[model samples]
Target chain A: MPDVCKAPAAADALLEEERFQALSSGEAKIVEAAASRIFPTTDTPGAAEAGVVHYIDRTLKEIYPKQIASYREGCAALERNAKETFGRQFTELAPDQQDKILSAFEKGTASGLADASEFFALLRKHTMEGMFCEPMYGGNRGLVGWRLVGFPGQQFGYEDPYINRVVDLEPIAHEMPFSQQEALDGRKS
Target chain B: MAARADVVLVGIGAVGGILASELTAAGLKVVGLERGESPPYSDYALKDAVHAIVRHALHDSARHEPIARRDKEGENTRRRPVSSPTNQVGGALNRWTGQSNRFAPGDFKVFTQEIASGLAERAGASLEGYNVADWPIGYDDLEPYYTKYEYEMGITGADGENPFAGPRSKRFPMPPLRDTAKFVLFRDACRNLGYHPYRTPNGILSQRYKPPMPYAQGIPERPGCVYCGHCNNYGCHVHAKASTLYTHVPAALDSGNLDLRTRCKVFRINTSPDGKVTGVSYFDPAGTVQEQRASVVILGGYLYENVRLLLLSRSEASVHASGLGNTHGLVGQHIMAHEDVRVSGIFDDQIINGFIGPGSVGGRIDDFNSNNFDHTKLGFIRGATIGTSGSGTPIERYNIVPRGMPRWGADYKKYLTRYYTRSFDLNMQPETLPHKDNYVDLHPTECDAWGIPLPRVTFSLHENEQRMHRFLAGEGEKIMQATGAAKVWSAFSKRGSRWAGGTRMGTDPSNSVVNDKCQVHGIDNLFVMGASVFPTMAGYPPTATVAALTYRAADFIRSQNALFH
Candidate 1:
C-alpha cells in the first residue's frame, strides 16, 4: 500500500475524489459544505481540506450503519431550510449563507426539522472525529490534523528522561502510518 | 447437557478472576462463565485511538444490551448507547486506567461517622431519606487482603508517602511508576499549599518482573509499562498494565482446575425447590441454553448485571416467592456513584508534557479524602481525593481550552497548539452518599438482545453530595491556581450519573443484599462480589477494594468447605 502520509498532492486529490458508498450525492455536498464551515480553513487546513466529508461518508457506510438515516434526514432538513429561506438548495448557497444556515442548525433554530440540534451535534461530533482521527480513515490526510496541533501519532514510548521534562520533542513523521488493517495484519502475523 | 463443578463464577473479571484463582488453587473445580469472549492478550494490540477510545472496541456495544436510565422513580427511562463498565473476559479491567486505591479506614464506617458528628443532620442536607449504612467488615478485617491484592496485582507505589492511607501490613510490591512533568508540578503545587502530595498507587508494573513474586502461580515474564500515552480507556498493547486478563485469569488457568467458559452469558441463578441455589443457566455463544450445576454460585458481573440477574430470576413458583435474597425487596437499593469533579488549568509558562506517561503515574493528595478533613464547618459528611492524571490523549486535549475559547475556529486551533501540552486537570473523586430513592431495577419495556429486561437505574444526587462536589471543585481550583496556571476552570456531572451499586452489602438483611462475607443473605451457597457489594462508594477507584473483598470472600468460602461438600 502507498504511504498516505507521503503521498503527493495529485494522489491526495484522487483519494479525496473517490466515490462515497454511503451518502447520497446531495447529502455529500451538504456534508462537505457544513464541515468546511464548522471547521473553516484559515491559516491551517480545516475539515474540508482534511477530507472530513469522505471520512464521515465512509464511516457511515462501514463503521456506523445506524447513523446513515440520521445523516440523510439531517441533510434533507438542511435542504428544506435552504429552500424556505433563500429559494435555493443548500449546495448552491454561498459560503457565508451556508455558515448562517449551519449556525442556526447548531443553535437549534432551523425550522421544519425534527431534532435539528441532535443532527447538528452529530455532524459536529463526526466532523471533529474526522479532523483528529488517523489518516488511514480517509480524514486527517497527509497527517495535517496531527501537524495542526503538534500531536505525535502513536509513538511507542517516551523515554524516562523525557517523562519529567518540559522539552517539546519533535513529532515523528511516518512514511506509511499503519492503518487499522495493517495493524490487525501485523498482530495476526 | 449439564456440567457440574464445585463452584460456578459468573463474570470472569476483577472479582471473579481473583476468586477463580483462589478457589481453583484450593482444589475446587471452578467454572467461570463470561458473557464476552476471551480474545488473545495480543488482540489488545490495536492502538488506534479511534478504534480503542472512540468506538470502544473492547466493550459491548449498547445496541445489544443498552442500560436504561432515569433520574427518579415514575420517570420514563431512555436506553443509553453505552454502559459505564464494559463486559469482557477481564471486564472493565482491560480498559481501566489502573488507579489502584484502597478505600480509607473511614470509608467503611460512613454511617457511624455521620451519626457521631451529627453532620448529616446539622448540614440540613435532607438526611431523612438517605439510607447510608456502615460496612459489616471493617478496614482491619480487609487490611491483609488489601496488602495481598496490592502485591499480587503488582501495584506500584512508594511507602510512607500517603499519610492519609489506612495502615498496611506491608509496602507495595513494586516501586511507583516514574512521574511525568505534570506530576512534578502538581506535587510542588500541593506541597506549597500545605497538602501532603504522594505517588498514586497503580496496577501497572513499574519495572520488569523480579524474583519472589507474590502469587502462588507466578506472573508471566512480560515487559513492564513503557509509559505509552494510550493507557486510559485503551487496553495496553504491551500487556504491561496488570489487568486481570494478564494476571489473575491467566494464573487461574495455570492452576489446571479452572474451566473458564467465555461467551457464556449467565441469565439466571437456578434455584432448588428447597430454597437453595442449584446452579446457573447461561446462553452459550451459539445461542444454545446450557445449565451448569455447582454446590456454590458466585455473581461477580458488573453491578447492574448482578442485580438484573437476580430480578430476572424472580418467579411466583420459586421457593422464596421473591428474587433470591430479595425477601425484603432490597436487592437493588441504595446505589451510589462517586461525584467526579474535574478542574483543569492552562499554563503559559511551562509545558507539562501531559501525554508522556501511564494513566495513573501522577501525583495525588489524599489529605482531603474521606474524613481526613473537618466536615463540621464544611456542611458535608465526606470528602474527595485530589489527583493529577497523565493519559490526556490529543483528541481529548483538543476540547480542553481556556473558558471563553471557541470550540472550533482559527482561535481554537491556535489554543490547541499552544495549550495541549501545557494544560493539566486536577480531578476530584468525591464520595456520594446513598439515598433510599437511588436504586436499580429492570426496565418495564426495554429488553436486551437476550430478551432480558435492561437494567433501569433510578438515581439523583443528594444535596449533601452536591455541596461536597462544590467544595471539592473549589479545592481543585485552588490547587490548579497554586500551580500558577494562567487560567483554571471546573466541570461537574449532573445530578444522576449511575456508576456503581444495586447489590450492596451490610450487616442487616432488612437493608442490604449481601452480608459481610459478600454471601447473599438467607442463601448460604450464593455469593455476590465487586462494587455492587460496596455499602458506600469511597472517594477512590473501587478496583483494589473489590480485589481485596474477593480475596476475603474466597477465603470465607474455602473455610466453609463442608457446605460445598
Candidate 2:
C-alpha cells in the first residue's frame, strides 16, 4: 500500500490524477472557510490547517455528485447572506464574525437569514464529514481521530481479546501524517 | 444461436455460485448467468473503498424509481416514489454485515401449524386470502447443507452456544470476532443483570482457514479479517468476509463451466407448448433481446426480482393466471420483511471506539427472539432478538445527543462531548410473520428503465409484531438501565407498515411458491431463490439463512438430476 502519511508531494501525483487541484479559487476559499469553522483550530489543528478543506474540495469534485450540488448551493447562499447582512462576502469576514454567523445559522437564530442557516448547516455537516471520515479520502490527519479514540487500525480478529480478557489494544498507524510517500514508493520498487 | 447447457444458473450469487461449482464438479456442464460485472480481488483493496463504500458502486441506484402499492381494496395504489435496488450479481451479499443465523426449526412449519390453525378458528378467515404454508423440506433435511454453508462461508461463532438454536453436528468454522467496546460494556452489563451472552454467529472469518482437505475448490487464498472499520453495509476490502463473490463465484469460474453475462436484465422465462422451459429472453447490455436455452433454470435472484420475474412471465389462459408457478395462485403472496427498532443510552464514563469495527461483531441476545420466548399469553405469535453494537462515525456521533439537549453552544457541546464517550445503543430485530394482506405486486403507475412495472411492496406491522417490538424494547430498556446508563432513549414500534408478508411456503402446492427443494410448483424446471421463499423471517439477519437455503437448493437440484433429461 502506498504510504498515505507522507508529505503531500509524493502522493501529489496521485492527488493530481484525482483532480484535487481542480477547485476554482472561489470554491477553494469557500471550502477552506467552511472546514475551518466545522473543525476550528481549538484543541487541535483546524480542518484548513490539516488539509481537510483541500480534501473536501477534492472529494466533492471526485466522489459524490449529490454533495457537490448541495455544496455549490450552500456556497452561493452563504455569500449572498453575508453580502446582504454585513456588506461583505463570507470568506472576507473576521474569525469572530464568521463564528457568530455560523452559530446563528446552526441554531436557526439568524435574523432574516433562515434559509442561509440551513445552507451553512449543510456546509458544516459535509465539512466535518470529509475532515474526519476514513483516511482513504486524505483526511483524518494520519488517522489522528481514530488514534484519539484508541481504535486499533485494521487488526484482524479480536477473539484473542474477547475470549481471554479486556485487552487494551495498541493503536496502529498505516502511514505517518506527512513524510513517507517516497519510503513507501521505494519499498514497493 | 441457442446456447445449450446441462444446467443453467441465473443470478451467480450465494446460492447460484455454490450450485454452479457443485454441479460442474459433479461432471455436469453448467453455465452461470450473472447481471453484474465480475469483481476481481484487487477491486476490494483499500483504494477501491471510496468507490465501493461511499459511492455504493455495486448497489442498485434504481431505488428512486416510482413504484405503486396494492391496498386493502384490491387496487393498485400510487407509490411515494420508491425502488428496491439491491446489489447486481451477488445481490445484497456485497453490502451485508455478514450476520449469518438460521431460522428456528419451527420457522419452516409456521404456516401450517400457526397460520393454518388460526384460519380454522377465526371467523371469515381462511388460507384462501393468504397462501402461507410449510416448507416442503425440514431442518433435518437441510442440516448437512447448513454445515457446508458454514464451512464455505467461514462462519464464526460458538456452536451449540445459542440456547434457542437447533442442535448442530459441528461447531462454527471459526470462533467469533472480538467484541467491540459497546459489546464489552453490553456483555458485562448483561452478565451483571444475570443474563448469558454468547458469541453471535457471523460469516466473517477471524482466522485463516487451512482446510483439512482442499477447502471449497478453486477458492483464492483469503486473508483473515483486518477489522478495517468498513464492514457494516459495505463490502469488506480484504475478502475476509466470505461473500459468494469470494468463496463460490471463483470456484465456479475455475471449473470453466460457468459463463457470466453482465448487465443482462432477464425479461421472462420462455416455455414451450408442452409446458416445458425452452429458454429465457433477456435484454443484454446493448439493448438486444437475446434468448438462451437451458436444460434447467434457476431464479437465484434476490426476493423482489425473483417474484417479479415470475409475475412478468405469466401469460393469459395459463392455469396460473396470477403468475408463473402460481397454479395455486400463491406466487408473490406471503412476503415478510423484518421489524427493526433501535434504542440509545448515555453513560457518564464511557467513550467506545464505535467506528473501529464491523457492524455485526457485537453482543447479541437471541434468547428473546423468534419462538424462543413464551408468547402464548402476550397475543403475539413470534418474538425478536435484541442486540447492541457501535456503528457511529465521529462526525455523526457528535450529532447524536440525548433528547432535549441543547442543539449547540457551550452547554450542548459540554454534554455531547462528555457523553459521546459513554454513549451506547441497542437495536432489536423482531419477527414479522406472513399476513394475507401484505404482498408485492406490479405497480399500476410506475415503470423501470426497461418499462417493466416496478415491484410495489404493500406491507405493515401486524398487531402481533407491534406487541413484540414493545416487548423487546422494554427488555432492552431494562438492560440499558441496569448497565448504569445515565439516560436511555427508546421508542415503540413505528406505525408505518414497511414490513411485508404473503407468498409464504408449505408442502402443499396450493399455498406456496416453491416446494421443500425450493423448486417452483408446477414449473418443475424453475427455482426461486432468496428471502422471497422464506416462510417467515426469523428475528435476525436473513442473509446467512438465505445463503444456507441457496446451498441446500443447489444440492437438491444436483441430486434430483431432473434437468439433464
Candidate 3:
C-alpha cells in the first residue's frame, strides 16, 4: 500500500507513452488537452496526472476499436474549429479557450464535427474512468484519483466496525509488489 | 454429445443452480445447460472497478446482444443493451447486491388483498390496463421452503427484526450483519420519523458458517464478509457471498448425478406432438446444434430470457401453439419491474466512509413496503422499501455529487474531494405494478449473436408507480432531513430493475403460464421456475424469493409422479 496523499512531482504535461496504440502524437495531444479541460488542475491532480489520455488510447485499442474513427474525426474537426475560432491548434490554446471548445462539443453546439456530443460524452466518461478506475487499466496513475477523493482501492475488510469516519491509509493497487510497468509493457504489443 | 438425462434445466444461475443441486442430491440424473463460460474466481478480482462497472466483465455487454426497447406498446423501439443477464457461470447472482428478502404475506394475494380489497378504489388508482393478480400459492405454502433455501444458501439476518416479514420456521443460518455508523444514523433518523428500520437481510454470511440440516451436504464452510466495498456488480473474492456458484453448483457436481454443460445456448424448448417437453435444443460449445432427452425440462433462465425462449419455441404443431405454456396467449405478459428511487443528503462533515461495506449490510425500513401502510388517497396501492445505501468504488461515486454541480472541472472536483464521504443516500425500490402493456415479446428487427430475435421489453411507469416514487422519495428526503443534512436532492430512474414475470404462475390457466406446481398448464412435464413465474414483484431483491420458489419447485418436480408418466 502506498499513501498518494503526498504532493506529486507535477500535474500538467503532455503524456509521453512509449507509443500511442490508437491515437497519433497530434491526436493524443488534442485528446489530452480536452481531457485536462474536462478535469483541469486547480489545486490538485487532474486528468493529466491520471494519464487519462493513455487510458483513452488503450481503451480505443482493446475494448473500443469502433470508437477510433469517431475520435479521429472528432479530433480533426475540433482542430478545424479551434483554428476557425481561436486562431490556434487546440493544444496550444489557453485553459479557458480549451474549455470553451470542449464545452461547445459537449452541448452539441460545435460545428464541423459529426457526433460531437457523442464523442465528448465518451471522452468525458473515459476520462473519469481513467481518473477513478484501477491502475491496471492504464489510468489512475499513482492512485491520484482515489487519493484525491479519499478512496481506498481494494483494501480488504477492516478488523473492527468503525465504518463512519475519515479513513486515511496507504492505498494499494492490484499490481502492487509488481510495478505498473508490467501491465503497461505487456499491453504494448 | 447427444445425451439423455432424467431431468434437464436451462440457465445454470441462481434458480437453476438450486434445482441442479437439489435434484441431483435426490439421486436424479440432471443435465444443466449454461449459456456462458465458467471463468475462475481470479477474473472477479477486486480493485479493478473498470472491469466490473465499465466493461461489465461478469455480465452481458449491450453492444453484442442488444434487446430492443420501447416505452409504449406501438412506439418505434430502439435497441437498448440488456446488462443484467450475466454471461458467466453464476449469472447475475455473481454480482448482485445480495439483499435477501421474502415477498411479504400480502404480496402473493395482490389481487385479493389490494386490488379487490377496495384499496384501489380508496386510493383512486386506475387499473385499466394493469394485470395485478394473486399468486397460486401464498407465503404459508412457501414458508418451509423459504426456510430451507435460507439454510441451503446461508442468509444473514436476525429472525425477528423485520416485523413486516412473514413467520419464519427457523432462524437464518447466520445472525444479522453488524451495523455500521452510517446504518446507525439512518436507523435513528427512521426512528425519529416513526419508521420501523431493521438490518437488511443479506445472502452474504455474517460470519464464517456452513449450511445446516438436510440441505448442508457437500457444501463447505464460507468465510465471513469483510465489507470490502465491492459486492454489487463484483464477485466476492473471499467467497463470503452465498452464491450457488460455490455452494450448490459444486455440491451438484460432487453428487455425480449432475452433468453441467457450459457455453450451451438453448434457443428452443423442444417438444413432441403429444405436448410433453422432450428436451431442449441448444447450440453447444463447438457451435453444434444438439439436444438432450429428458422426462422433465425446466425453464430457469432470467425473466426476459425465459420469455424469449418461450416465444422462440412457439409451434402450431404443439399443445402451446402460441408459445410454450402460453395456452391462453399469456406467456410473456403481466411483467413488473422495480424502480430505484433515491434521495441524497449532503452533510457538512464526513458522516461515514461511503465505500467500505456490502451494499445491503445497512439499515432499512419496510414500514412502507407492500400493503404494510394505508394506501388511502395516496394514489398508489403498493409502496417501496427505503434504506441507507453506499457508494461503491471511486468511479461508482464519481457522478453522485449534489444537484446543479458541473459534472466536471473545479467545482465538481472540489465538492467530490471534500464531500464524497459527507453525502448519504436513502434509496427506495418502489413496487412497480404489473401492467397489461408492460410486456416482453420477440423483437421484430433486432437479432442476437445467435441469429435469434431478441426479446423486446415494452415498459413505462404508470400513475401508481409515479405516485409511489414521489411519496417514497419524499419519505426518504424526510428521513435525510431528520438527520439534519445541509442539502438534499432526490431522483428516480426511468428504467426499472428486479424484472419479474413473463410466465406468471396462477391457479387459473387463462391468464397464467404455469400452475401452482410450476408445471406448464397444458404441458405437464415442462416446468418454469425463477422470477419468470412471479405473479407480482414485491419491492425487495427477488433472489431470496426466487431461490425459495426454486426449492419448492424442485421438490414438486422430484415428487410429481404424473410428470414421469
Candidate 4:
C-alpha cells in the first residue's frame, strides 16, 4: 500500500549521475571526449556540459541496443587511435590539441588516426544528435538548445496567432505525455 | 496441438478486420492472429511526435526486417525475408496515411492496351520485354467492395467530384475534410493551371461515427479529426482516424464467434505433402512455438512477408522446387516502387498557411495519372498523380527557391522569411513500370534474430518511369509558375524508392504469385493480400487500392467458405 513517490530513499543518485554511473568506465570516457568536439563550446553550453555523456549512457541502456553496441565499439576504436596517434587519452588532452587531432583525423591525413577516422566521425555524429535531440532524453535539459532554435514543446495545436509567421516562440518543459507511474499504480490524478 | 476453428485469419489489419466480422456474422468460429502488440487507441493518441514519428514506434525497424533482393533470374534461388506489419491487432492499418484514392479504370488493364498501343506506335510494342500485365480482375469486380470499405470505415469524400475518376454507384459516405488556407491555394493553383482540383478521399472521419452494434462495447468513442498535423506515416493518436481498430476490428472482436491473439509471429505455413495448406507454425510473444490448424491459412502480412512465407514454406520437391506457387519462377519478380518527385513554388503575394493542415488533406490533379491523358507523343507508358499534400510541420517547411533568386545567405533568407508562410509544393507519385530486372529475394550477408535474411531490394526505375516523372515535374512547375508563383523550381525523382511491388497477382501464375482471388496458385488454402498482389504500381498512393483489394479478398474468402475448406 506504500506510494512509489513517498517511499524511503532506495538510493541518493541524481538522474544524470545515476545514468553516467551506469556506463562502463571506457564508454563514459569516450562519450565525454566525443561530446566536447561534437558540440564544441558554442555561445551556448556544449555537449559535455549539456550531459551528452549521460544521454549516451541512457540511450545505450534504454533505446536502440543494436546501434548502441556499434556506437560503443566505434568510440573504443577512436580512443585507441587517439592514444596511438597523439600519445594521450581523449579526455585528458587540451581542447585545442583535441581539435587538431580530430580535424587531422577527419581529413584522413593523420599518421595513426587515418584508419579510425570513421570511428571519430561516428562518435561526433552520435554526440551531436544526443545534445540537440528532443529534451525527453537527458540532454537539452530545460530546453536550452531548443530555446536557442525557437522550438516550443509539443503544444497539441499551434494555438498562437503568430504560428504561421516566422517568429520565435518561448521554450517549454518536456511533458512526459504518458506516465509509467500511472500504469504501475493504476491511479490517475 | 491443433486448435479447431471455423475461420483462421492472419494479419488483422484493414483487410482481415473486415473479413473477420463478415465471417463471424455468417455464424463461423473465427480466430485471428497478429504479430504486433495490442495497444489501445488512447495509447496511440498519446504518441509524441519525436518518439513515435522520428523514432518509428509502430514500425520497429530494429526488430522487423524487410525482404531480400536479387536479380530477376536469381529470384528462384534466393530466400525472401519477412517484413513488418504490426504483430498486434490492426496490423499496418494502425499507421496508414489515410489517403484513399481509387485506381483509375485504365490502371487495371493499361499494360495490355494503352501501354501496348503506345509501344506499338513507337516500334516497341511487346509485353514480353517488360513485366507489366493486366490485373486478374477489373474495376467493376471490386466496386461494391470499395463502397463497403468506404462506408464501413466512414471514408470522407465527394462522388462525381473527381472529373478523372471512374463512375461510382453512390456518393462517398461522408463530406470532405476541412480545408486549410494551404489547401485552398493549391486548389486555386491547380484550377488556374487547367487542372481539376478536388478534395481527396481519406479514411479520417470528417464527422463522428456511431456504430450500431450493441456488442461493440469497450470500444472508445472518438470525435472527428482535430487536424493535429501528425497524419503522415504515424498512427492517429485520436480515434478519429478510421483505421481498422475503430472500424472492422472492433466489430469482429465484438462478435462472440471470434478469438484474437496478438504478438504471434507466423514463421511458415503448415502444408500437406500434396500442396494443401493445413495450418501455420508461429512463435508466440514469449517465444513459445504454437500451431493454428484451420481449414485454410490466410497470409495478409503486407506484400513482403506474404511472398516470403510462400517461398519459405516450399515443400514437395517436384511441385514447388522453384518455391511455392512459383512454378513459373516469378514469385518475387516484377518488384515496383513509387517514383515520387517534389516541386516547390514560392509566391511573393500569397499568404498560404503551410503548417496547419492534415498530411493528405489537399487537392489532387489526376489529369496525368494513369491513362487519363494520351501518351502517344510522350515516350512514357505511364504517368504521375500531381497533388499538393503538405504535412505542414513547421520544422519541415522551408521556403521554395524562386526562378531567379540567389542561392544563399541574405538572398535565401529574404525568400525564406517572406515565403515561409506563402509557399506550397506540387508533389507527384509517378507510376513505376514493373520490370523483370527488379525483384526482391534474401540478402546473402545479413540475417535477423529470427535467422531470416532481410528483404534486399534490388531495384531501379526503368527509363519510362524516369522520363515520365521528369515530364510530370516539368508540367507541375509550369502549373505553379503560371498560377502566380513568383518563382518555381524543378524537382527530380529518385530511382527505385517507392517500395510497393513484391507479390503480383495475375491470370497466369507464370508471371504472378497469386490468382484473381489473391490465393496462391499452387497452394489452394494460402491467401496473399495487400499491395503485393498489385500487378502494376498505380500513379496514386497505394493505400486505397490496398484497402479495396483487402475487402474484395475478404469477401471472396467468405463466399467460397474458405474457412471451412
Per-model CA lDDT versus the true structure: 0.79, 0.64, 0.81, 0.65
In candidate 2 the C-alpha lDDT for residue A179 amounts to 26
2 or 3, greater by lDDT: 3
| Residue-wise C-alpha lDDT for candidate 4, range B227-286, written one tens digit per residue | 666666557766677777766776677777878888777777777767677788888778
Runs of candidate 2 with Cα error greater than 4 angstroms are: A1-41, A46-56, A63-73, A79-121, A134-189, B47-52, B57-89, B111-137, B210-223, B317-322, B327-329, B346-351, B376-379, B391-399, B406-423, B491-503
Give the TM-score comparing model 4 with the true structure, all chains together: 0.80
Distance from true position, residue B500, model 3, in Å? 0.5
For residues A1-189, could you state the per-residue lDDT of candidate 2 as single tens digits? 223222233222333444444466676676667567665544433454346666676556544445666666666666766777788988898876777767766776665554666766666655555544556556655554443334444454344433212226664434332223222211111
Residue B94, candidate 2: alpha-carbon lDDT: 62
CA lDDT of A172 in candidate 3? 74
lDDT value, candidate 2, whole model: 0.64
Worst 10 residues of 3 chain A by lDDT: A180-189
Deviation (Å) of B430 in candidate 4: 1.7
Best by TM-score: 3
For model 4, state the Cα shift of residue B391 in Å. 2.1
How do the residues B1-565 of candidate 2 rate in per-residue lDDT, one tens digit apiece? 5568777677776767777777777777776666655544433333223344444432333333344554454655765432223435555566667777776687667656565666323422222343345666667777777788787778888866677777787778788877677787788888887676766787778888633343575666676776665665556777777767767777777887777777677878877765677668887878788888887888776656677778888767555456778676666676776657777888766656565557677877776775565555565665667777646445546666666875543455355445645676787777776777777777665777778888776766566666667777788988888777889877654433223333444577766767767787777787777667777676777766666777777777778765777
**Global local distance difference test of model 4:** 0.65
| Candidate 4: tens digits of C-alpha lDDT, residues A1-189 | 112112121112323345453467667766676566655534444555556666667655655555665665655655666787678887777776676666665666665443556655656545645544555566655454344333454545444323235435454444652234124112111
Residues B403-473 of candidate 3: C-alpha lDDT, one tens digit per residue: 78888778777888877777778888888888888889998877987889988999888888888888888
Go through the candidates in order and give each one's DockQ.
Answer: 0.40, 0.14, 0.50, 0.11
